[model samples]
Target: MRQMSVRRKRRDRPAEDAAGPQVPDLATKGGRLAILDDTEMARIHEVSVTLLAEFGMSDAPPIVAELVCAAGGRMTEEQRLTFPPDLVARALAGLRRDVALCGRLPEHDMALGDGAVHVGSGGAAPMILNIDSDTYRETTLGDLYDAARLVDALPHVQFFARSVVARDMDTDSLLDINTCYAALAGTTKHVFVSAAFPEHVADIAKMCHIVAGGREAFAARPFLSLNINHVAPPMRFSPDAAEVLVAAARAGLPCMVNTFGQMGASSPVTVAGCLAQSNAETLAGMIVAWLANPDVHAVYGARPMVTDLRSGGMAGGSGEQALLTAAATQLARFLGLPNSTIAGATDSKIPDAQAGYEKALSITMAAHAGANLITQTAGMQAGLMGASMEAYVIDNDMLGAIRRSLAPVEISLDTLCATMIAKTIRSDGHFLGHPQTFDRMKSDFLYPGLADRRSIADWQASGARDIRVQAKELATEILAGHFPQTLAPAVDATLRETFDIRLPVARMTKP
Candidate 1:
């Protein structure tokens, strides 16, 4: 009777009372929340087109420059390639809008072009928040692998990118190879990884080929993609990164042209100007990718970063940052290309109230704006410089709440059920054991694993643990016991023999 009473109380509680922190969404199919009107959007587009035709982009490799020139772009004496509006329009028209990010497992595949929202983890932070010690420490290759595995188990985290840099790896080449290996071995989900050197791309591709059984098979369904920070803000290509983009394009690997524009620092302070600059630079990157291969699959990564002018530091947790990223998502839709952007990154050192509000505000804006791929949604802190295992678990719950907000409410004659309502009122005075409640429980509501839900008396009696403490305990248990064996022993042996795979195979299979 006591257990039954408790279950009845839980079922009767209102959704708002039971829900945890939610990422927000207000728009749905047939209705959109637009931040910019059609005219404003057209004005931004015109500015971007003019910027490309006038000032142009710099630091293109000789071959890339020649390709652009052949496509009717003008290479100035100063080596800046000025793209005519016609060239930009041509590239935009020929852009591959439909893109597939495949997972090693079939169920994890996601389509990007249809405005489907997918949230996941991202960043290459150098440090991690050690929950046990409550101190910061350098992130290692093992930390990166563990992050992937943890996110793999999280239902809301649909994909995993290499979230932290492996500082213990000595050489750049070794770092690049081991980063790829660690991420691939940790999860079957599609991985987004960056290479330290352009020359190492072919070798990394070969390793991926072996994992996929053969070269053609890997090309047919790539489980891994490359993130190229191909261009710096203010219309300039980072030469080495551009070379890598070229190589990845030649190999036919999917790429995300990620460019960060820090408002008031690397870009204009005004929001409109910042958006125009970012859009121009992003379009400039697409032109280069098209030049590398006309058929290359790419995503427009418009990262709207913020800086504290008073302190000269990154303010990723600010409202301005959120607005800019949401606006960037709108621009991607306007261009008819798949897009990605960063949000939910907090400057707080730990998962506290500051982290919660900052994360919720930015993440809700991005998700509500219909972003296809919302990155940096988990395991990041201190403005993308630190990551936390416990934070990942907490963020997963938050994402659940946000997703629920997006779900449309249904109302129809069958759902209304006038007869059932009348019978319940007449018979029980409350609908405790209604068949409708039991049938829709799982489908209608999201229950978080880490969120606390107890009365004051029960909580006190049960040794009241804070949500962070509970989350820490849960994260530790998962890390200790969850050793996913995605790769077979023979395949692991072959990879180790072939490349400088630094992460020990034993560590992957054992806690």
Candidate 2:
């Protein structure tokens, strides 16, 4: 009778809470949620389950499967398995909901999933710049350190992205995980990562140890974060990837399952198809993780790009780009989760006319669509390869402009008070020094060096500075004036010990 009473209370609670206003239709507001009907979502969910059960993920290693099974799952054929929800829930039962990324300023409590727009640097894989030379060389540890420093130095950089560089010892996949952790721990910034192996998950545990101080630190407040990239299309999760998802849940780490879709290839050629596919991918990963542990803290992140068949290239930023971005944002909200799409990307390699339009259009839509966190804010060129300081400068300026686009139009009496308008009513109306002029003009106006708003003669007199020129100049300013946080002596020592595999250089790296 006691056990029956407990279960009854649990069952009754969900029903009691189900009453509420229906979710606002994001699509009717020109958003993407309308693309996914309940029937289609159910169908895709079944497809993902079937794929996991029948095909299973490739090379999940018996060891990986064993840990899951030991945790009360049943594995039949290679990928055919079932997780007892009760057992999964027990593992995540102790998990927390919030993921607070620390900032250099102690007052800046950078929390994720709070519906605020938090921007950072992000990009697609496949090296564009030679990170070795810091100009044209392959990616290296020195560059990674400088990148972290640079990001830490920027006040608006809410979280530190792996930014760029391989920097891993011998290119072993396992080495990448902790290498990033060490870099993040050295700075007072939160990190974003691509954890490739499950064994490396323990390295993330070490990161949590360093940042949070141990299991208690993690349980109390987790600083460790992970990025899980779901397979593009004909979607499936790899066994190792599956293990990492479960690992994060067991360790109480927050993971963002990112979708990198290319239209007409991995998804339907239409925007609606892309939304359904993107939703399917995210829901599948979430379901797998949630079913494995309902207490897991994972967000749906979409990094989808369109494949240009004619050129055999991926379109980094363009008008069609937002179809994936805006729709994905709607999907995330539809499922009651946070969203991660992108900003600061361009399809053009050279910073030119095309790059300007593509980046501006796509980024504006991402903000208006309401992505909680957007990546690729800087250092993108040539469709996400070609990361450059010049590009980073351009992105920051561009982001400033795009954010303004999303600002709500002024319609309130506070904005259009007739009394204030009438107070300065003169025939000449030259109230330049009026009190309202000082108060209100500053709020609505943004002076721009990158955005062109000048007369023809004035423009010519100023040497007609294009965005690229401004970008280069701004990049120089950041390198010269921006200052990253100074590390604690003990933390500095640990950073050295962790990466002392090679000699350290205190200056810019050579190719």
lDDT scores for all predictions? 0.82, 0.57
Off by over 4 Å in 1: 1-31, 416-433
Each candidate structure's TM-score, on Cα atoms with residue i matched to residue i, is 0.92, 0.77
Q: How do the residues 414-468 of candidate 2 rate in per-residue lDDT, one tens digit apiece?
A: 7676775676674446667776666545555443334555577766776766766
Residue-by-residue lDDT tens digits, candidate 1, 121-239: 99899999997988999999999999988887776777898899999999999888899999888888889998766898898898888899998998778888888897777788787
Off by over 4 Å in 2: 1-100, 104-108, 113-115, 124-136, 173-178, 185-187, 212-215, 218-221, 230-232, 291-293, 409-411, 425-427, 449-464, 480-483, 498-505, 508-511
TM-score of 1: 0.92
Candidate 1 displacement at residue 456 in angstroms: 1.9
Clashing pairs in 1: 23-402
lDDT, residue 119, candidate 2: 69
